[model samples]
Target: MKLTSKGRYAVMALVDLARFDNINPVSLRDISLRQGISLDYLEQIFSKLKKNEIVKSIRGTQGGYVLNKNPNDIKLTNIFNAVDEKVKTVQCRKESKKGCNGKATKCITHNLWDELETHINTFFENKSLKDLLNNNKETRV
Candidate 1:
């Protein structure tokens, strides 16, 4: 399954926050410039993050946003769900119990994709922002 820009950008933005968390309440504009993300887009993404309590906002001249939880406690799945990013591996209409074939019966290949999707979700559920940071450091080394 492909991760949408909202999901990817949110994760990147949060990582940027975690990276500079020592400063506390890093502004979206700063994250946007550093990560090459659009400030407007980051604002929209952060709105949802705030709603989910993944990030907290502070007001004032030095106000911005900060992580609500520690980086190690913030799972990748949390980021994905906060932005409503669906990890869809199939073309099936999820509202219906029937498979992508639009019939009452399940498609022949439905189980394969379904299992793969489960594994994909589990992978994200197990991964945290700290994991991403550690991986990045390894690659840089």
Candidate 2:
């Protein structure tokens, strides 16, 4: 259930957006520098996010990207889906027969792995990026 680099960077990009007080766009170059992501890579990710309505861009001297919705309105799953981040812990986690033995006895811990994966996927699916921000605030004060 590890997040792909795309997903990780996407979240970081959003967090950078969250930090800014103004709806004014933040340059990709600045986000890349602050978040330690590549400009080219951020551009590519932003294309997908923009298409999905997760973000909107403003042009001109103030040009850059901003969230289409408020921070609390965005979900982690929304960001994850924007990048095609799958929740499988292994190929077999999705019923792939590539490496699995047919019998349950052969894969002694198959059920456990499957259950764990289900729980993880469910958690991420239900949780939102907004929840993350709320929790952070709660802990601080």
Candidate 3:
């Protein structure tokens, strides 16, 4: 399964925010510049994130955004779900008799892809923003 820019950018933007938001709220423009993401696109992503309560906006002259929960509390799956990103591998539903290959039964590799998708999703579920932050720090050293 291919991850769209919305899913990738949302993670990048949040990582940037997590790095600096402790000092103050982070502006979408700042994250846009730092992450090389479009300001308008970030706005759209943030709107969904806000709606999902993944983040909260501060309104004022110094207004911006802050995470609704701690970094450790925010899993990659949570970010993905908040942005309506699906980690789907197969094109067809497993429950449905219709197959992705247009045949009566699923292709030989269908179970393989489905199992991989489950593992990938589980990895994301186990990983938190705090884990990413720590990994970043380790890589820098």
Candidate 4:
């Protein structure tokens, strides 16, 4: 699956929020600046995240966005899937007999597509935001 810029920025925004308390929201400006994303774009992406229940928004002087769940409870797959629904690698796929159009068996490398999708799902599902933090240290930042 190919993640669009929206998906990538959404993940980055979430990771930034993960560093702070859930009760405390982070301003869109701050997130945009830190992630090098445009504030307007982050605002749009955040609205979708809020709709998905992946984030909670607050309105006030301290208004901003925060995660709805513990970072550990939020799987990377959730973030990924929330922003990008095109989770399959296969393009123009189909099936015939088993309702399989030209998309599935029509391709000479059907198994490869299936295997790749499975691997991608497995990798993301097993990963969490905490894993990202625990594994990385001394980042360029």
Q: What is the C-alpha RMSD of each candidate to the true structure, in Å?
A: 1.8, 3.4, 1.9, 2.9
Model 1: per-residue lDDT, tens digit, 3-40? 68999999999888988877777998899999999999
Return the lDDT, model 3, position 113: 90
lDDT of each: 0.89, 0.78, 0.90, 0.77
lDDT at 75 for candidate 2?
76
**Which clashing pairs does model 4 show?**
93-103, 94-101, 94-103, 94-104, 95-100, 95-101, 96-100, 96-101
* Predicted structure 4, TM vs. truth: 0.82
Report the lDDT tens digits of candidate 3 across residue range 43-140.
Answer: 99999989988899998888899989999999999999989899877778867778777898778898899899999999999999999999999997
Question: Under the 3 Å rule for N, CA and C atoms, how many clashes does model 3 have?
Answer: 0
- Candidate 2 positional error at 107, Å: 7.4
Candidate 4 local lDDT, 1-141, one digit each (tens) = 356887778878888888865547889988888889999888888887888889988898988887888778888788877776457776644533532343324566667888888988888899888777666544635
Clashing pairs in 2: 76-129
Ranking, TM-score, top scorer first: 1, 3, 4, 2
- Residue 65 lDDT in model 3? 95
Least accurate 10 contiguous residues by lDDT in model 1: 93-102
Which candidate tops TM-score?
A: 1
Which runs of model 3 end up more than 4 angstroms from their true locations? Answer: 95-104
- Reference-based TM-score of each model: 0.90, 0.74, 0.87, 0.82
Q: How many backbone clashes does every candidate have?
A: 0, 1, 0, 8
